[model samples]
Target: MDIGNRLKTVRQQAQLSQRELAKRSGVTNGFISQVEKNQVSPSIGSLKKLLDGLPMSLAEFFADAAESSSPVVYRLDDQPELGSADISYRLIGSHFPGRAISLLRETMAPGADTGPDLLSHAGQECGVVIQGRLRLTVGEQEFELGPGDGYYFDSTQAHRFVSIGEQELVLISANSPPTF
Candidate 1:
């Protein structure tokens, strides 16, 4: 793989400068510069440090590089799967063209949750519950949402969700800045 090009692309996509990335990754700016210029090959550990500055995992970085078709219809079965064992997300705009935002159909199994840790990212988010119930905590406020309930808020605030009902909960969620 073209590591230099990949690093450059990921950094640019993240809107991070070499200096900013260096500071965040705890590496020298010269090292980031060298890597981007293809002047040096970084060891896996070093590369991992760079990826950390992007605040993204290696799997996510590579996954975004896998090209997909544009301006096409994505059938239900064609949606990409995201998340882990407790939750599953179906990307809504997988085949849509010029998508400026991301949408998801997320399923949270009964008693499942995103953990106690709150997630904060740059974006605006909105969602509508489709089935069961969910407990949403945004910043210092918390709300219990039943089926057909909805919510909208800034994603920069720390937030988390939990399935509070006996059945699985499904939500249709949308986000600007494409956090997915």
Candidate 2:
């Protein structure tokens, strides 16, 4: 697979410019340019950073590159978008039958907030902030996190995410019913 081409396609489809993605991904624009041109191969860590801008994962990216149809991989590029007014999430593995869990790649625009509400449900949720900063409100507590910060909590707690900085926020999350 041409990783550079795939990267470029996903970035454009996400409506991101190379500079914008670099800013969100915490990499230099020069580095993004080089990656897109296939002039440099990104380490897994570095590639994960780049994938943040597209709100994707290394598993999802590589899954799409595989040629087999058995076991059915849900390509990141083909994931369906799900969102309310302020926050948007891409649902991963939406088409799978009897999906006991779900994964999502989320993006929140600056100044956007997902309203605070207690969610009473089964299962657990864990997320890693991939870009910008996020203010998470759970029950009576609130916390702020920058890129690479991670959180895991019970789904029964009321929680919401707010973008706290000028840049957009990105997160990779997994939950049951799967969090679409």
Top candidate (TM-score): 1
Candidate 2, residues 28-67, lDDT tens digits: the string is 9899889889999889899999998779999977775463
Worst 10 residues of 2 by lDDT: 64-73
lDDT of each: 0.87, 0.82
lDDT of 1 by residue, 1-180 (tens): 677887887787678899999999999999988998899999988988899988978776566556423436667878889888989999976645336788899999999888889989999999999999999999999999998899999999999999997999999999998877
The CA-based lDDT of model 1 is what? 0.87
For candidate 2, give the lDDT of residue 105. 88
62, model 2: CA deviation in Å? Answer: 28
Off by over 4 Å in 1: 1-72
- In model 2, which runs have C-alpha deviations exceeding 4 angstroms? 1-72, 116-118
C-alpha RMSD in Å of predicted model 1 compared with the true structure: 9.2
What does each candidate score in C-alpha RMSD? 9.2, 17.2
Candidate 2, 9: how far from true, in Å? 36
